[model samples]
Structure formats: structure tokens, C-alpha cells
Target chain A: MSQLNAAARAPLDSRAKMIEFHEVHKYYGDYHALRGISATIREGEFFSLLGPSGCGKTTLLRTIAGFEDISSGAVLIDGKDMSDVAPNKRPTNMVFQSYAIFPHLTVGENVGFGLRRDPRSKAEKAKAVEEALEMVGLKGYGARAAHALSGGQRQRVALARALILKPKVLLLDEPLSALDKKIREQMQVELIKLQREVGITFVLVTHDQEEALVMSDRIAVMFEGEIAQLADPETLYRRPNSRRVADFIGVMNFLPAQILGEAAGHVQLEVGGLGRFEVTEEQASARASGAEPVVGFRPETLTILYEGQQAHDREAPATIDEVVYYGDMTYYDVKLDGVDAPVRISMRNVFGRPVLDVGTRTRVAWSAGALVLFR
Target chain B: MKFSSLKGYAFLYLVFLYAPIVLLPVFAFNSGTIIAFPLKGFTLDWFRDLFANQTLGLALKNSLIIAVSTSILSTTLGVFAARASTRFKFPGKTGVMGLIMLPLVLPEIIIASSLLVVLLAVGMPLSLFTVILGHTLMATPYAIAVLNAAFSSLDRSLEEAAYDLGETKWSTFRLIILPLVTPGIISSALMSFTISLDEFIVAFSLAGKETTLPIYIFSQLRFPKQIPMIMALGTCLVVASIVLLATAEYFRRRGLAKTGAKDTGGFL
Candidate 1:
């Protein structure tokens, strides 16, 4: 965790660019698949392209692997032009979504397939294959038929096969989408650990927001063939640049607000139910949705006040409209005294505390610093 | 009791289909020259006569040559057509594939007559080569049908993965694709060989001088002395067909098992 944090905190200028897409655009006949995508993936960083399906995240990743040609602009890898290079000639490898292990080959043969052109001796290549299998926790599984392995095992074999080549960049296209929930989570952690151990630049494409947050050092959230926002996970979750981005990343409650004025470094706003408050300019996203101004805050940021509990920054009186009980937390849809619609508030279930029921009058604690003003 | 009538119908259907084949071996071993039901003492004279016939031997050679050439040519053409149809999209793709597969539905006599006219108009000599050409035209559509199933069932990502893992397109096809589809290729070749061996109309229409096995069998049907020898030959063909079909099914099942793919119906 410390190592991951340190990597995340490292300054952008400290690392060299591994992949650079300069205004890359791709068109499939009349349909625009990638629209002027321009981003640089730094060396050894665990980067992710995240969005819902058909957002062209996978298409952008394929441009790096030379599987798809861009309509215009350039994609450079390691400071060199890669437009003319074929997938086999490029210094990158991919773990396909289907985990395309060769059904006719054994596990070891599949892992060692890329070494056919290498100048190493047969015994040395065999040793390398064994080591690669062991690295993915599949020791002594080299001789087994690849088709007989389980889904998780096939994923491991694919990883070992790609990693054995020691390419400059590793591309993964929703590699965990096929596995069940439990195995998917386990593989996510294992992938992070593997990425850190190798220190190779890993570019992952996924639609799962939580998986991206838990695995990526920095994420590029895309929508409609365009990147909406690119930032660290914390920044993306806390300060999404647009309402659409905010809604896509996680649950954020939006309430109507009137922007009074801007003075000094703070913008004062009259929130419909929470009353007037001032927030810094950094808390306001500059891109407007052309809709009315609204104040957005996460569910966990609002806490339902208990008996004798003091409000930290500010307080609002509300009536519980609904209650959803989870083992670790309880979510309440509370209608503020003056607001027409209910906003969800999530509260941790502490020991010996009674579960609140619907229709109960309560006071909810909130802070102005936790809110984001979206124009 | 509800299914008793259905069971009897099925039994009758099977016997109707197989009873003639059973009669082939029964008459083959009977000593009587007449094909009537009264059985004489067992004798191998008809089998000896079948082996000693030189015209039959020549016809068998010609048929083998045609069948082997037809199988190789048709299967090679099938691979190209199947790969093209499955892995690409171009203008008139459906129409083009439909035209290529049109021979499967066209009557063999029509094909034979049209091909005979075309060959004569072009001043091409009719021989075993002509017979092979006609048989390949008739058999390629079936080959492609079998190969299309094999190629389409294959996941496209498998090829991409091989190419991504430092393999050129040709090498990937050779090392990854060829082995996976070997059973389909075998099935296709056997199908073409069987079609060519038993085909009569095209061979009769195109072969000006050379005679294939089917033409020989048809010619021998008029003579009473050669009837038992034809039965002996028929017995050999039946056994050969069973062995061939069983071998193909074995390979097909093995391929399916190797790939962990579900067995979706096969020749067996």
C-alpha cells in the first residue's frame, strides 16, 4: 500500500513517457470510435482507461497494440512512431478478454510460445517457462492441457504468457470480466501486485468503476469516444469535472443551488435545503452542463445525527423517507425540511446503536468542504 | 403401449434402410450364380472372379485417381472459401458465397451436361482429368459447408492472441489454426472422396474414354455372370465406408475433446 501510494504521489515530470497519443482519432466507416484522444502514459505507472461499454476505451487500447489503425494523428511508444509496426513487431503484449490460451498446447508450451524466435537454448527457455508459470502461482502445472484449466487458471496462464516476453507495456482488456465476483476481486489484487513487482507500464481497460479505483494509480474516465476527465482516483471521485462524470464514477446527490456571487477566492451559493454557504473556487467544476447550477455531495459525506450527537460543521433537520440496512452500514433517504426531493445519506452502523426507522425526525450533519458546485 | 406403434415404425425404417446392404454380403458368399433366395453351399468363387477382372481393376484405378485428386482439390478450395467467408466482410459477400454454394443444390445431371457442353466448346479432351474436374465442382460446396462450421466455431481471439504473441500471420495460421481444423479437413476430404467414388452422371457425361468404378458397376448390371462379383464388390465397399465413417467420427470427437468444445452433432 505504501509503495502504491508513493508511486501515485510521484511527480509527473519524474518519469519518462511510455506511450503518447497525440490527437489520435479513429473512424469505423461513418462512426467515430476515438475522437482526438491525447494522453501520455508514464513509465511504470498503473494506468487505466475506464468507461461503460462502447465508449471506445478498448479501441484506444488497441491503437497502442497496433490492432486498430487510427484515422488520423499519431500514437508514439517509447518516443518512437508506431504506425508502421505490426502487433508482433511492437514491444507490447496483450491479455485478451477471452484469455485465448491455445487449446492444443500444454500450459508450459503456451507460456513459452513467444520464445520461439529467441536465441536462447532449449533448456534455458524451458527454465524460463517454468519460472513464468511459478510467478503466476502455477508451479508444477506446466504439463497440464491448457483447455482443461478453469477460468481463473486460464487467466493466470494468459498473464504468464504475456509477461514472459517482458514487453515494455502490458495491455489488459477487461481481463477479469469473465470471472465470478470472488475470483475477480482476488485477481485484481494479484494483478496490482504483479504489476508492481515487474514495474512495467500496465494499461488496463475496464467498465467497472470500483475495480478501476481499487487498482489504478491514475484513471482516464471516458464517455462517447472522448475522455471526460483524467486524474488520480481520489481527485476523480472527489472533484469530478462534470455532472455526467460525477454520476458515472459513484453515487453523488445533486440539489438545486443558486450562485449568489464570487468574491475573493470563494463562491457563495444558496443551497435549496442546506441554506447559504461559501466554497472555494477549487471546489467548483468549470465545465457547465448548460443546466441549472447544483450542489453535489457524496452519500457518505452526510451523517445522520444520533441522540446527543453534536453537529460538526452544520446541521439540517430531516425526516427519514426510507432505510436500507447493510451489514456494515445503513443508507437512509432523508427529506430535508425544505427540499422537495429526498437525498440519500449513508451512516455506519455502530455497535449498540439502534437502527433508525422510516418516518422518524432526525438531524443530519454535513460540511460545506465536502460539497462540489457544478454549474 | 402408446409408443409401441412408433417403435415398430422405427424398426421397420431401419430394416428398410439396411436390409439391402445385408443382402450384399449374403449373396456375395452364396455359391449360386442366380440372385434368388435359395442358398447353395458357401464358396469364394465370386470374390476370386472380382479380383481377377482386369477391366474392374482399371476402373478402380481410374476412380481412385479421380477421388484422390478431387478430395485434395476440393478441400484446398474449401479452406480458402471458408476462411474468406468467415473472417472478412466485403461487397456482395453474401451473394458471392451463395453462388459458390449453389452447386450443392443444382442437379448433378444439369451440372454434368453444362460442363460437358463447356468442355466440348473449349475443345478440351475428356478423360480422368475431366472427371476429376467435374467431381471437384460437385464436391467443393460440401467441403466448404463442413469447413465453414469448423472455422466459424473457432474464436477469433485465438488467432489474434497468437499474432500478438510474436507470431506472423502465416506462422499463426500454420501453428495455431492448421492443427485445430485438421479434423474438419479430414472430414471434408473423406466426404469429397466418397462423393467422387460413387458419382455416375458426371463421370458418364464427361469421361469420353476412361471408366470410373460407378460406370463399371452400372455396365456390369446387365450381365447375369457378373452379378455375384458386383455383390462381392458391394460388400467390400460397405465395409470400407463403415470403417471410413467411424474413423472420421473418432477424429471429430477427439478434436472436440481437445478444444473442450461441446459436441454439437457429428457424422456418427
Candidate 2:
């Protein structure tokens, strides 16, 4: 576990860093948009900026595309400072959220718009447009009017248009937000495959956590114009460095805990519901929030031990306060003995397993390794 | 019975509004000079008289020149103002846009008098050029109103997308913004032309020797024999106005359809 922690913490040395933000700050008059953002995006990696709206995720993405000028710091693409670069001069293309398909042009003309300055012959440009259309699964759609396409098809056209230029970096600004849910899910998977095939560094800005987790190799979770945590999807989900990141990534149950003391490389803590337990240094997060210190655990970390089942770790007595029955799983709000508030637990409903009713007594099993202490 | 009376009221209101205008061409085509009740035999003599009048022809040429110049100048200025207001954020933007749009609601007499005063104070000679300047000032607010609708409805990402696809700012505006807003430009030009052509107060206040059609028609109203020719000219203007307004409305509707935007009510 310590080796995995060190491995995750160490600087990435294998792959080339394709983009870097060095203390980049952006201000819109009196409003500070991006605050000292510094990170390295690796080559050919699917990176995402995940945050709530107005958290500067889109601002950071625009800085790379040169659509927005940073007020203070430098944005380096391929290790070159891009302070004076114009958007058209930058080696980046963006798939805008609105798709921005030129309504006046046909699909072919829209895709070939970037090649106007190229010295290629007419037939070659036409063939290039055809190949780009086919790459985005929109074959034979070149002659169609751009405005006549459906929402998803317009998105595919936007992708083809941006990718036709073969830019070094592809920036996507909430590209799937305009699509319906079913299509959005499908396009998320397709975007990942497309990124792999193109081998260009992709920077995606999205507010949806599930989309970020599903499509990105690493995510920088931002809040209030600053990145709260930058890690892989697994680390971001399991060991979120801050309480806000833990709450943003997924569902986590936080219970107040009293920090007893710190010993040699370990911290002893007393949890409200599960009594005293010693947590390792890596399991603890040093966020000095003014509120009370708490211990957080994912819903799946706590389990309901049924009859004839033995716990792999410690067991606590609890009563099922509420039951929410999903098709494949059942969620229970279980209140442990002497704990005032109920903590949520998710149990899978395999065949022949009866769901426990509300107000029923049960034994809840949890492991100390899965707990994250917030101080 | 109440609903029937209300419908009758609406019918009577429309007839009251259109009755005088409908009579203009009726007398214009009448052979008899007296414009009273009884219908006279139809003749092409009054239309023939309008062509032989040299001063009226000169006035017509002057109005055309002033209208065309005003339309181009006002619409060009409208495009700049509308683009700036919609696509950017500057200090005191609302105040700047409000001042530019003030001519729409300002009384035409006040605008004419102030412009005449300013021009004479600056020692500028009053000619068709001064009248064109005055007409452009009067018509630009309307041009901006129509053009604001054009530019504000445009998705800003379209320009960014063009820039992202390796096009410079000038090419993006030329290829994308110019084509998309062509209908708005046409609509604004037509509106300004119509307004400038029929404008009497500014032309009267600004034009020293270059008499516009309206002023010439007003001066000729004193001669009873020239009344029929003036009515004939009014008939032509009425038809031309309807055609111009219809064409403008068509372009506006086509613009809405091309952009796939929801149709709010238009000028027509």
C-alpha cells in the first residue's frame, strides 16, 4: 500500500509532458477566474478538468487553446511558452459545446474550412474531408446541409472538423452536454476510442463527474477557481485529499471523529459510530477545516452481514433505518448502536437473497483500511 | 351580438385607416382633374404629365441618391455598433448602446433641427450630401435595432470555432459573420432606404437647393392642375413602399429560417 502511495505521488517521468500550466492566473476585471493553476498533462493522454460550473475548468481549457489570455502566468504547450500566440496560430482545436457547425455551408465545406490555406488540390482536399467524415462514423454525410443534421450528428461533424486539422492538442468544452442522456453515454465511450486512435493529447472540460471518470486517464478536480485534487480516477475516488473532492467525485458518508494523537508515522482517532481505530499516515488527509474533524467511508465499504455470514474485519450492531430497493441492489440507511445519525450502506441483491426491511436488526461489517480520516 | 359588434368595430377601424390611401390611386388614374365623388374615365395622361415635369424628375433623382447613400452609410454603421454591443464587454456598454439607439425614440424634428444647427454652425453647405447625413442619422437607430437582433441571436461559439479551425479573425468575420448576417444587412438597408426616401422634415431642413420628392410634391400641391400628377406620384410611392417592405420582411423571415431561430414578431 505504501509502495502504491509513493508510486501515485511521484512525478510522471515516463511520458512526455505535452502541456503545462505554470502558476496561470486569469481575472475578468475584479473577478478572479483561475487562481495559480499549475499542472502537467502527458502526451496522448485523456485528461479532464472536472468541477462545478464557474470553477475555471473551461477557463483553463481555453488558456491552452489560446482563446483566453491568462492575466499573470504562462501556459506552455510542448514546452514552449504561448504568451503571445493567437488562437489561430496555436496548435490546438476545440470542439465547442454548441458544435458551432457552420449553418451556411455543407458538411463537406465545413470540414474543409481549415484547409483553405493549404496548397493541396481540390480533389485531395475533397478526399481528406471524406476520410475525416468516415473517421467520425459520419460516412456519406458530406453533401448534407450542416443545419439539417441531428444533435448527435452535428457533434460528430464538429469532431471531424476539428480533427481534420490534425492539431497537436484537441480541446473539448462540454461537447456532450447538448446530447440526450443515451447518446451522451455512447459518445463518451466513442470519444475515448477516438482519442486513442488519434494519439493527440485531449483536454476535456466537463461538469459531470461520471463522464470525467469514465473518459479521462486523469482528472483535476477543481473548486472555486483552484484545483482541489489532481489524480487518477481510482485515487481521486478512493483517497480524495480534501472533503470537497470526496463529496464531489461520488457518494461518501462523513461522520465526526475525535483526533486522539499522532504516534510514529500513524494517527490514532476515535470515530463516533465505530469507536477507536488507528489510521496510517497515508489514510489521513490534513485538511484543516474549521468544522469538526470527520471520518468518511464509501457506501460500499460498509456491508450488512446476513445470517450464517462471518465478517472479514470488525462487526458493529445496527438497525436498518430506511431501505431503498433498486433493481440490482438495495441501499440501507443503517444506524449503528449509540450513533445518532444513520450511515448509508449498499448491498447487492443476488438471487435468493432477501432484502432486509426497515427497522430490522443487523450486523454491519467494516474494515479499518477503507476509512479516510479528515482533519 | 357583442362579439359581432367588436368585429364590426375592427372592420370599420381598418377601413378608416386605409380609405384615404385607397383613394390616392383612384384619382391618380381618373381622367378628370376634379378629385370629387363621381368616377371619371381612366386615362394615362396624368402618368404622362409626371414624366414631362423636369423639376419633379430632378427631385426624384435627388431622393434616390440620398436614400441609397443613407441606407449604405447607416447600415454599415449599424453593423459595427451591433457587433460591438453583442460580442464584447466594455466599460459603460449599456450607456454607449443606449446613446446610439436614442435616435429611434427621439423626435425627428428635434434631430433634424439639431443636425441643421450643427451643420450650419460648422459652415457646411446644405446639399444632397447634408440631406444624406441627416437621413443616415435618422435611420441608423432603426438599422441598429434590426441588426442587434441579427448579431445577438448568433452563437458566439461560431466565431471561436472558426478561429479554432485555423482561420484568422478577418477570415472568420468575412466567411462566417458576413454570410450569416447578410439578411440582416439587406433588411436594414431596405428599411433605411424607405425611411430616407419619404423623410420630409430632414430633407426640408437640410437640402438648400436640392429638393426631395416630398418637398417638390408639397410645393406642387398649390397648383390645382399639378394635383393629379402629385397623386400619380403618391400612387407609385405607395406601390413601391409596399414592395420594398414586403421584400424586407421576406429577407427577415428567411434569415430566421436559415438560422433556425424562433420567430419573434418582425417590423412588418
Candidate 3:
């Protein structure tokens, strides 16, 4: 399906969209961990809090979980004030980063553990446990001890335990972090599948941008203690609203950008070092961005030449600084003098031919449409 | 496994500490009631006489009640202390923790006398109630020590996960936290019980009309003929101490094993 069609048909189900934090501040006695966080989480949507470590992403998640109360401002969940709601009383469940499976309990016990007073009949509880285990692909493993499971197995167990409770929303705090790379990829796919099947709101906190992009329906890019941008992963990656968001999500070449002209349709930007680039509203509304913009172009969109003079308007002459071969594509870190940072261009081997070498002077070329100018 | 020779050091360690406890039952059966090396005919007279002595039995009953009360109360306090110290960041946290642990280093005599003076000044009479209060205060730090091991080493993410799973703070602690830290709680309770049982200075100073076993043993030291009976009682106490200490150690070791922590340093 086309991106437009998918977005046009996107449904915001009864996702606990009831989360709101109004001017909330958290202080660890002078060290302001969360300066002033104001955010609303829509229920049923898979929203990911993405940032580097110590960006207060986990703190945000904990605050939502009621583990850490906001020092100031009121937080509401499901339209009820959550300033005094304890973690246990909240209608949310979390899959922790370490996959905090109860070490002393077996898989079955861990899954049904939260349902202490859940008046589910024995058969119903067993059925739920079995279905949850099966959903995570650990059907028969319910009898296995939590300690005996491998990291991935343990992660699945943690997921099943939380999922079985079927809370209004599920909070995943880097739940797949403990698994090996291969298993992490596999589990990421499984997690996305499970999130869809369960149809519960999921708020995932992760420092890993790749993982966030891979799993989240919408991503909230956090910096320090505030959300820099909240948009779909593609929007977040393609045209990050801020220079900080652009630098965070993926590799981008930032050149000093100025508005040459702004009309009702498109905005003309004079990007220093890389020359002029035009951005249209059909790409992403520039008004939501800024007036004076910082022009950025994704590395993968740029084509690096071995040796050539570009005759096109969207060409930047630069010397190939570094070359990184990543199996499917080769990344050329091109350095154009007078630019603030090195211009990165990733070229895939379409016809089994290699591109520019390191230290080799080359011209990087891309479409005027490919370059994104953000204010 | 390569530290096989460390087993020898362990053996020596046990013998050095418990050789006396091993001799208690041996001397308990001595017909002479005297604990000398020369072979004495085996007799159950000391134990029979101990049962027959109404005051001694009363002392035994009093000590049991005090220790049990101290264990239950101190361990309860320890649960809160352990949870607070592990889970939250409070003001003056370190200083407060140091103060709690101060009793561990302070001499028992000082604690006893100071407590005695304070209680008297407040018009509280010396009795089993006062003894329980003092013993609980003294045993609390050890309870904290044991429970802290369990609480600190616990997987905190588990608790976070519980909260995310729609569990209230109280429910999570009741259903999940307590179960995970059960071994530590048990170990703490046992350690407190034995510490109170074997404690003397505070109990002696506080026992007005009520004498605990340790105070009774101390009083019997005044008479010459009572020496043998003291040994018999000493023998019994040695056995009790070893049992209590061993059980506490067992639970502690089990708690550590549950958390997958290395046995770096432990109670002998």
C-alpha cells in the first residue's frame, strides 16, 4: 500500500489517549532530571520515546507508570488525575529492559502472577497463559523455570507475563535490549506482530533509534528532557523538524540554510556549501517547521560519483573523506570545504560496480526533492 | 572447583568456631555435672533437674517469648527499612542509613545503660516489655543487613514491570516483592530471633521481675555448686546457638543463591 493510503486509513482506536502531563517537573534535589515535560499519549497507538541515554526518556516512562511522581503539575490518565495514583493501580503493564521475569517462579506462574485476584476460572487462566505463551512462541515453555530460559526466551516470558494481564496499555522499557543481535531482530518482528494482535496501546522507551524506527507506529524524539518532535517514523526520519532531531534519527549533512523565498506552495532555501534547494508542502508542511531553515539531506538519497563534474542543479563537489562498506551499500563521508559537517552519501551497488575511493575527490548528486530543508 | 583447597580452610574455620558447641552435648551427660576431661558416667540428671527447676523453666519461657517478639517486630521494621533504602531517593539518605547501622558498631553496654536511663526517666519500668523493646532495637540493624542483601540484589525491573502490569504499589509489594525476598526475610527473622535469645547485657539490665535464659545463666555464676549446672545450661545454649546460627546461615546462603550473587563474605 502507498504511504498516503495507509495514513489516510489510519485509525486511532480507543487507545488510552487519556495521558496528559501539564507542565510537569521532576527534580532529583537540584539536578533537574525532567525540566518541564508536557506530553499526551494517545491510547492504542504504539508510541516510542526515543533518545540517547540520560535523556530522561526512562524518567518519562517511569512517571507515566506512576513510579516517579512529578514534582509539579498534574498528570492525568484515562481522564482521571494521576498525581496520586500508585504504579500498581495504573491500568498499564510494562515489559522491562532486563525482562524482569521472576527468577523464583516458573513461566506459567510468572504469566498469571499479576492476576492474583483476577476471578478468571482455572480453565480461563490456563487458557490465557497458554495463548500468551503461544503468542510469544513459547507455548510449551510455560513449565520451564524463568532462570533456565535464555535471554530471548526470558524476554518472551516477560512479554507473555505482561500481555496475559491484558492491561489497557503495555509499557515496554527497552524490553528487547538483553537479547543478542540476531534474536533482537527476530524479537523486534515478533513484538510488532504481537502489538498488532493484542491491539493494546504500547509506549516503548528506547535509546536505540533503529529499534524505535523498526517497532513504533509513531515516534517521539526526546532531547534532554523534552520531546523535540512527535511524528511517524518516516516523517521523523525523512524530515526531522529540528536540526537536533535530524542529527538524532539518522545520518544527515547540515549546512547553514536561509529562506530565499516563501510562497503558499513551496519555500526556496539557500543552503550554504551545498547550494540552493526547494521544499514543497506536499513533502511536509514547512510552517510546522521554521522560517529560517537548516537544510539537511539523507545520506542514502545522495549518489556519490567516482570522478565526474555534475551538470545538474542538485550537485555538490566534495572530496571523499571516508569509505564504509556495509555489505549492501557503501557510505562515502564526503567533505565539502566551508560546510559545518562532513556530507554523507550512501550508494548501493545496483550493477555490481564500486564507487569513489577514500581520499578521492568526487561529486555527490541527488534530486532537489530529495534534499530536506528544516527550519 | 579449582579452589578445592579452600575447602580445607573452610573445615578449619568451622572447627575453630564450633568445637566448643560440639562439646556441649558431650558434657551435658556427665554424671558428676562437672565438665572435666576425665571420663564421667553418663546421666540425664542435669536435663531432668533443669526441667524440674520451675524458675529456670520460667526463665526459658520468658526468653523464648522475648526473642520471638523481638524477631517479629524487628523483621517487620526491617522490611520497611530495606524497601526504603533500596527503592527510593530520600533526603539525608546516606546519613540516615549510617545512623541505623550505628548500633551495630556501638558497644552493647552503652546501648543498654543509655536505654535503661532513658526508659527510667520516662517512668517506664524494667520488664519483659522493655527487654523486647531493647532487643528489637539491637537486632534491627542485623535484620536490615540481611534484608538489604535481598532487596538490593533484587531485579528492580521486575517491580517496574509489575507496576506497568496494573499493580498498585501496595499490591506489587504484597504479591510480588514479599515473595521474591522471602528467603531474605526468613533469614532476617531467624538472625533476629537468635540475637535476642543470646543477648545478655540489655536483657539483664532490663529484666526486673522477669529473667531470660542468658540472665539466669549469668546469675547462677555466683554459687560454686551451680558451676556444673551452668555448664549443662551452657551446653544446651551452645547447641541452641549453633542451630539458630546455622539455620540463619542456611537461609542467607539460600537467599544469595536465589539472587545469583557470589558468596563474597558471609556469617560463619
Each candidate structure's TM-score, on Cα atoms with residue i matched to residue i, is 0.98, 0.95, 0.83
lDDT of all the models against the reference? 0.93, 0.90, 0.79
Off by over 4 Å in 2: A1-12, A286-288, B1-3
So what's the TM-score on candidate 1? Answer: 0.98
- In model 3, state the lDDT of residue B101: 86
Ranking by lDDT: 1, 2, 3
Q: What is the DockQ of each candidate?
A: 0.83, 0.70, 0.49
TM-score of chain A taken by itself, candidate 2: 0.95
lDDT per residue for candidate 3 within A188-232, as digits (tens), equals 877777776787878899888888888887888888887788888
Candidate that scores best on lDDT? 1
Q: For model 2, how does the per-residue alpha-carbon lDDT over A275-366 read when each residue is reduced to its tens digit?
A: 88888899997463547888889999999999989999888899999999998989999999989899999988899889998999999999
In angstroms, how far off is A329's CA in candidate 3? 2.5
Residue B37, model 2: lDDT of 77
True contacts kept of each: 0.79, 0.79, 0.75
Candidate 1 docking category?
high
Model 1 misplaced regions, further than 4 Å: A1-10, A286-290, B1-3
Interface RMSD of each: 0.9, 1.3, 2.5
